[model samples]
Target: MSDLIDDPREGANEPEFTVSEISTAVKRTIEGTFDHVRIRGEVGRVVHARSGHLYFDIKDDRSVLGCTAWKGQVARLSVMPEEGMEIIATGRLTTFPNQSKYQMNVQDVAVAGEGALMAMLEKRKKKLAAEGLFDPARKQQIPFLPEVIGVITSPTGAVIRDILHRLRDRFPRKVLIWPVAVQGERCAPEVTRAIDGFNAFTAGGALPRPDLIIVARGGGSIEDLWGFNEESVARAAAASGIPLISAVGHETDTTLIDFASDLRAPTPTAAAELAVPVRAELLARLEEIESRRISAMRTALNYRGEKLRDLSRALPRVDALTAGAQQRLDLAAARLPGALTARVDRGRAALSEASGALRPSLLARTINSARERSEDRGKRLAPALERSSAAAQGDLARITKRFDTLSLAPQIDRRNDALAQLMRRFKQATEVAHSQRARKLDALDRLRLTLGYKATLERGFAVVRSAKGEVLTSTKLAKAHAVLDIEFADGTLSIGAKKTARPSASVSKKGTQGSLF
Candidate 1:
């Protein structure tokens, strides 16, 4: 007013400002004060623009500030902005002086220390470990023939495909899929849920319980694979009664689930390998055992044949000893003294009668009569004596021959008897061999029961199955796990169930229950 010029309707002349003038003055003031500065902060709200500009917010727990990088400046950045990463951003401060708005035009960026993220990971790992999630005792052994294998992974990812391919190639067993999110914010919860679902199914008896469960994912950054290391997922794996095989990330990377699970496989293929025995190897082993059995039986038979040969060779020696004794008996019979005495007695009797009739005529008569009688007796006795001697000689010879024959016969009889005895002994030996064979067979049967997969099936202990025909080994596969098939001695049953506490009797096998056929 002091220097005012008179205007129409008593108005005073005043200085007017243009938009460009105000804007330029504010912009110059902001450029002068801040020039260039660098601030360290956690990156947040980072956005990449379609036109190559980058917009972001830098934050601490208590505060947030906006940041931007133009296309030209963005090209110069050496590192990408990641959420929760502490970084140092070099930029000049600029102001929208009209509205008094302020932001940093980021020029360069570098990583700051990652103390907070490390602290969080360490805390979680400790918490989970303290809760026994990594205890070795919590692990379960994987089934040899996993009728149904459960897999938890990103459904559409390469991890799932890899697992499927490996499983098919190795085992070709049935798989029960519990599709889960394997990465991102929701991954931890989904993995935990899948583990829980598997547990419930194993415990309850609806879906056949997976004999083994596989939790697998492809390789990724620590943050991307963090879900497997989550306390929730680890605890769920620990709690699952069914065996779990963890396959997460690369071979070098280990997660919390690896400690919590029954086994840790470097890749999905390794998981499948751990879950099943190699079929070819098993078949080879069976063939080897059969060959060994056949070899053993052949060896047994050969040994028995050798023993029989030894027995056969000993038979003739016993017969020879018997023949010599019989020869001595025959010789004593041929030289008898009794026949000599009988001939001498007749001559002595005739001499005594001649002496008793000593008168000459009487003597002559006696002598004549004695002589005639003697002649008559001699004539009769001559033929008789000759016949007797001949008979005695013949009898002696016959007796000698018979004695020799008898001795030999006895020897032969003894040999024959020994042979019979040997036969009996052989029979006994064969019986012993048979008894040993029976014992071996029984032992083999017991071993078969212990080692054979079907032994348990025969023992009235049937594997429960799901409606989909997968064997249920545990309760983790069902919401309310139900027994589908009841395998019996004769056949299988499609059985419905009720809650009964009484246990069923185990299957008794006819072959093993003291029955030899």
Candidate 2:
């Protein structure tokens, strides 16, 4: 029986084992042999499982290797595996007993080399570009001087220091640092969150929304700055409501963020410079503008004053205008006295003639006697007097016709009165138009001041917001957030400080993760 048990065909020489036992032995052998290996192959057929596990194939020309990355491992991957990409995967080889298959337990994945990385980056770029994420029309114009600036970078990096120093030298501005990982897998996501957070601020928050954003990193290799090349980071940049400046790597180092950003800076320090103008230069410019405005106002006033003086000089004096009328009145008065004297003399002479004619001696003389007397004294004088009496009797009869003519002096006076009425109407119309235009300009200036948001902030009010920048209007909302930001007229203050202030970190931010491989 022992000889039978030791038979080669039965168990001893060939080895006898159950399926589970054999699988275990194989798993151990493979795991031990390929433990902590660095394998390079082209990625193929990637599957992102619903349970946050990853399954994929990596192959050379002839052989294929299956790989698996757990949920935890996925987070550490520098670049997720994509089909046809050449990658260097670090992990251990293992076998599954149930499926009778061998695979790699991948801890991380990286593009095989710079060439492969560049190729992948180029592909991603093309894809994002096709979606119009890089359109210039989608870009916001950078504020000439941002009141608040949000910076995303590593908390501990020299990049932040350089940025701060440069900003201090140029124009000092309020900066809110969103600490993040500037590299590694966390970099892209962290940067994306920082951008979203800045945008989430209440329009009227005490911690006001950033007018500008800067995504900055110091000079580094392409591999070191790979986080900025992420599609998510690029998309976030494109979607930013605030104007964004990208300052990743050195002057020659380019990333997808640079393309999507409103502006691109060569370095982190350069980005600070781009964010604000020189303080002294701005002050000088403002002073010059104020001076110009004052000068222009003074010049206009002087011109108007001189023009008014000229008009006044050209106008006839009140006394001069009345002089002609006064002289005419004087002449009329002088003529009136002389004419009255003449009229009195004529009346007396007429009365004397009538009295003489009515005398008894004259009346007693008949026409024949009067005629004989006239011929004796002066027949011509008597005949002439009789003829003049006969003519006056005829003229009196004729004078009874043709009455009702308007006099010249009264007609001329009416014409002058009508002219005066027209002059008054014209003066009123001109003055009315001038006043309306003046009011319109004044109203426009008033409207500009009234509608400005800065004017409202200056009124001693504050806006309550969470550190994430969401407006917390009530106590309940405030309770949900660990930290709070209060925006004041001058600046922002943080309360219930959950996140301690720290230096910068590598760029990265928040969201429901989709796929890591």
Candidate 3:
């Protein structure tokens, strides 16, 4: 057995170990070799976990190295790692015995160089451009004079002081400062949140909403000004309800936020100048306008006064125009009595001539001659009257006999038949009118059913109403915390209204379509 076992030293050279033991040995070797390192590579899939740990992969053309930045170390990183960004990560290598894996525990990270920074920026720019956030139509017009201007920057930095001083020189306005980190890992998130916070205020609340926003920073390199190029900052700026002014770096330093903003300023001071008009210039303009207005009014008054004088000279005197009519009236009054006397004398002469022709003695002689002739005629007519009376009695007796021969029963029967036929026709017309009225009533009933609201309710549609029962047809009218009742065909649902957010251009279009439905 001793010979078969061989030398213990020989056996020790070829060691037999359990899985854990082998893993531990390998971990020590790797960790000891790479105790501290500074590696440069392009970042791959970066995952920020809820536990505040960041896990990512750093890869060159040949191979990839797994990396991790713990919560504390991640907070200290100068540059937040993004996928496809080439960065230099400085940390110590470590191993996980459980999974038999080794990784770099990144303690610090920085952009590899200006070329990498520019590459990353160009990639982000393309993504935002595809979303149309940089469209000219989406940009807002900055107010000439904002009531409350919100400024986002590092409060202690010279940038803020410059902006404030410039604004003071131009026009004094109410400024609300939102202090944020101007660079480093905290910059992007802080800037994004500040923009959202400013927009979240109620328009007329105790803390009034800003009418315009200015995001300013002093001149710096691309890396120092990387926060403005962040996607979150760009989207936030694009989604701002208030018009935004981006002044990130010097005139040549353009960032993603500049495209999304309503206006871009070369410098922080220039941004302030754009926010308001110069006080002296505005006052001078108003004074000029007032002088012009007064001059115009004076000219108008002079023209009107001259016109009134010309009109008065052109008008004829009322008394002079009526003199001829007054004279004619006086002449007619002078001839009135003589004209009446001549007309009365003519009437009296005509009556005297008629009276002479009808004298009483001449009328009495004519009446005596006519009476004698009438008495002779009456004596001759009495004999003829007695002869005619006998013939008339005979004719009357013949006519009475003919009337008795004719029967009246047949005529009475014919009249009764005609009356029955007329009654039957009248009854038919009454029945026809009743049928027509009934048909019209039925048609009217069908029309009423078709036009009723019940028909519309049967369709798959609902009406949303507020607690006060007012219909909510617009998202703007839906207030936070208000109870909304959705009335369906079968039932109704009541829910609390959700707080509305600033919608992007695409989201706004979708919302408009939904409201129409």
lDDT per residue for candidate 1 within 1-517, as digits (tens), equals 8569654664446767788787787778877888889898888887998999999989888988788889988765655576667888898888665566778888888656546445545666787888777777766777779888899887788777777777676668888888887876568888999888887774346678777889989887776776676677888888888888999988988788888888999987778788887777888999999999999999999999999999998778765877888787777566556667777898899989878767688767777887887788777977888888988998899888878755477678899999999999999999999999999999999998889757776776666677787767654552244556655556777655443334334634542221101
Winner of 1 and 3 under TM-score? 3
lDDT of each: 0.78, 0.87, 0.89
Q: lDDT of candidate 1 vs native? A: 0.78
Question: Local error of candidate 3 at 147, Å?
Answer: 1.3
* Candidate 2 segments whose C-alpha is farther than 4 A from its true place: 1-15, 294-318, 328-517
List residue ranges in candidate 1 displaced over 4 A.
1-119, 202-205, 308-517
Residue 46 displacement in candidate 1 (angstroms): 26
Give lDDT for model 2: 0.87
- Model 2 TM-score is 0.59
lDDT of 2 by residue, 261-280 (tens): 99999988889988999999
With a 3 Å backbone cut-off (N, CA, C), the pairs that clash in candidate 3 are none
Candidate 3 Cα RMSD (Å) = 28.6
Cα lDDT for residue 271, model 1? Answer: 82
Each model's TM-score, in the order given? 0.41, 0.59, 0.59
The candidate that wins on lDDT is 3
Model 2 misses residue 392 by how many Å? 80
